[model samples]
Target: MPIGDINVPIVGKNVVIAVLVQSHILFAAFIIGAVLIAATSEYMGMVTKQPRYERFARNLARFVVLLFASGAALAITFVLALVTLFPVFFSYLQNIFFWVFLVEAFMFLGQIIIVYAWYNVWDKLAYRKNLHVVFGFIAGFFGLMAMTMIDAVASYMLTPAEAPATDVARTFLNQTMVPLNMHRFVGNFGYAGFLIAGWAGFRYLKSTREDDRAYYDWMGHWGIIWGFGFTMLQPVIGYGYMKGIRESAPDAFDRIMLDNAFTFNLLMIWLTVLAVAATGYFVHKLRFSVRPMPFLRKLAIGGLAFTALFSVLNLIPADGHIATGITFLGGEETQIPLGGMYPWKYIGLIGLMLVGFFVVALYLRASASGFHWGNASRWSQFALIACSVTIVFTMVTMGYTRESARRVDNDPGYLIYKCITLDQKVVSENCPAVSDGVNTISGREAG
Candidate 1:
C-alpha cells in the first residue's frame, strides 16, 4: 500500500473520548476531596460541641456520596472507552501496575461497604458515632490511596526514572510519585471546598429559620475557606512538580516547558493572580452574605468573559499553529505571538472556567424561588448529568491534542516522516525495532 493510502487512525475521536474519561477522573478527585473535608469536619465536630459544624458535615457528606457514585459510574465508562480505543496504552499500563489494579478493585469494594454502612446507620448507631466516623474515614482514605497509586504509575510514564539493575521493585514507585500525590491530594481538597461552598450558601439563603440559615451560611463559608485556601497553595505544589520533573528528566521537562521556560512560566503567574483575585472574591461573598454582592457577579462575569476569549485563542485550532496567525511586522522573531505570550492564557481559561461556577452560584443565589426539602429539582439532576458529559468529552479532546504531537518521522508537523523500513519505504507512523520479528509497543496493541 502507498504510505498515504493507509489512513492514520481517527486521531481526534479517540482523544475526544480520552478527554471525557479524564473528566470522570476529575469528578472522582473532587469527591475524594469532599469526602476528606466532610469526614474531617464531622470528626472534629464530635469533640467541639459545635452542632452547626456537624450539621454541615452531614449534609456535605450526603452530597459527596451522591457525586462520588455518579463519578464512579462515569469513570467506569472512561475506562471502557480507553480499553476500546487505545488498547495499546491500556495494556502498557496494566502490565506495569498489574497488581495495583487488583488492589484497587478490593479497595473500591471495601469503600462501597463502609460508605453504605456509614450513611445507613446515621441514627441506628449513635453510641458508636466515633467508630462509624472512623469507618468512613478509612474507606475514603483507602479509596484515595488506591487512586493515588494508580496516578503514580501514570505520572511515572510521563517522567520515567533510571531503573536500577535487577527487578528494582515496581516501576510504578517512581520518583515524582510522592510529589504528584501531594499535589493531587491538595487539589482534591480545594476543588471539593469550592463545589460545596456555593452549594451550602445557596441553601442557607432559602432557609426560613434564622438558625438554619446561619448554620448553613457558616458551613458554606467554611467549605470555601478550606477549598480556596487549598487552591491558593496549588502553585507551591506546581512549582515542586516542575522542579521534580526537571530534576528527573531535564530533557523531557525542557520539552514539556519548552525552550522559553520563563515565557512559559508566565501562564502560572497570571493564573495565580486570577486565582488569588478569585479567592478574594470567594471569601468576600461568603463573608458578606448579609446581602448579595455585585462585585462577585462582576468577578464571575468578567472571569467568564476572559475564559471565553482565552479558550478561543488557546483552543487547539483545527489546524495546530497559534504562531502562524500572529506574525511580527518583521520576521526578526522579536515580538511574541498571541498565544505565544505564555501565562496570559490563564487569564483566558480562568475566565471561561467562571461560566459553570457562575451559573451554579446564581442558581444558589435565587433562594426565594420556593424550595422543597428532600431530593432537589429535576434540573439539579440534569446539571449533574451535564457535568458528567462535559467532563468526559473535554478529557477526550485533551487526548487528541496530546497524541497529535506524537513523534512522526522524527520531524514536526502533522504528516512529517519518521523513519524508513528495511525495504526503504517511508513509515508514516512510529515503528518498533524489528527484533526477532516481534514488536514491543509500550501497550498491548489491538490487532
Candidate 2:
C-alpha cells in the first residue's frame, strides 16, 4: 500500500511517530550510557578495593534492567507505527539497508541476552569479579554495535550518500554518519553520568542514615566526573558533525546556522551558561583545605567570564539584514552575527570548550591530591543537580535543532532527504480510489 494514502481520522501520524521515537531515543540513550558508567565503577571497585564502587555499580545495573525493558517496549511500538502507517517508506529503507538492519537485530538480541544474564548472576559471579566485569563489557559492546547500526540509518536521512542504492556499503557510510556516531557515542556517556549525579543528589538530600548520605555523596561526585569529562569533548566533535552537514547539504546548514541562527544560539547560550556555572561551582567546592592553584583559579575565573560574554553575544539579535549570498525558505527568520561568522563564533565556542576542560582537569587534580568529595559543600551537590538539568535540556534542544533543520530545509519536506513519501506527494482529488492501498478517501478504518 502507498504510504500516507490512508490518514486515520482520530490520530495525527506525525505526532504519534514523533512522541514514540523521541521517547525511545531518550530511554535507549540512558540505558546505553549507564552500561559504560556501571562497568567503570565495577572496575574501580576491583582496582581500588572499594566496596562502595561495586555497590554503586550493582545498583546501576538493576536500574538499567528496568529502563531497558521500557526502552525495548517503546522501540517495538515505534517500529510498529512506522510499518503500519508508513509501510512504503519503511519498505524502501529496508530494501536499501537490509544488511544494516539485519546486523542491528542480532546485536540487539545479544545485548538483551547478555544484559539479563549478567544482571541475574551478579551475586553468583561475585567471587570471580573479573569475569563479571567482562560480562558487563560484553553487554556494553553489543549495545554500542546496535546503536552504531541505527546511527548509520538515521544519518543517511540527513546526508545521504551520493553513491547509487546498489552500493550498500557506500550508502551505509554516508558523510555525516561517522561524525554523528562519534557525537552520540560521547553524548550517551555524558547524559548518563549527569542523570546518575542528579539521582545521587536526590538520594543524598533525602537520606537519614549517615552511611547512606556519604555513599550517595560519593556516587554524585563520581557521576559528575564522568559527565563533565565527556561533555568537554563535545564541542570539537559537534563542529565536525556540523561541517559534514554543511558540506553535504548547504541550504540545510544555512537554515540552521544563519537563517535560524537566533533560536539555535539561544540553546547554545543556555547550554554554555549552565554547564560552565555548574562545573565551576563544583570545582571551587572541590578545593579542600589546600587553596586552589592560583593559576588554575584564574583560568576558571577567565572561563566563567568568557562564558558570560559568549552567552550575551549569542543572545544579541542580528541586524535585520540576512547574511548575503545565502537563500532560505524561512525569510522571516532572524540571524545572529555571532552565530553567522567564522573566528568570531569560533572564538566564543572554543573558549567555552577550553574552560570546560580546565574545570574538569582542576577537579581531577584536586581529587588525586586528597581533596575528599565526602567533605564537599552542600551547595556543590546542588550544583551537580543543576548540571544534570542542563544536560537533559541540552539533549532536547540539540535534538530539536537537528530534526527541525531537516524539515524546514527539505525540498517538498521529504522525511528522508531526496526520498518522496505520501506527505509530500500529491494525489488527484477526483481520481478513483486506490484499492491496492488503504484508502482514507471513503473513510475506511485504518489500523
Writing each residue's lDDT as its tens digit, candidate 1 over 349-443 gives 44434543553355346332312222233333233223223323333333332233232222432211122221234332232211224332211
Each prediction's number of clashing residue pairs: 20, 0
Please list the C-alpha lDDT of all candidates, in the order they appear. 0.52, 0.74
lDDT of 2 by residue, 94-170 (tens): 87789999999999999999999889999899899899999999999999999999998888776666655556777
TM per model?
0.63, 0.86
Which candidate has the top score in TM-score? 2
Can you tell me which runs of candidate 1 are displaced by over 4 Å?
A: 1-11, 164-170, 204-209, 259-274, 277-332, 335-447
lDDT of candidate model 2 versus the reference? 0.74
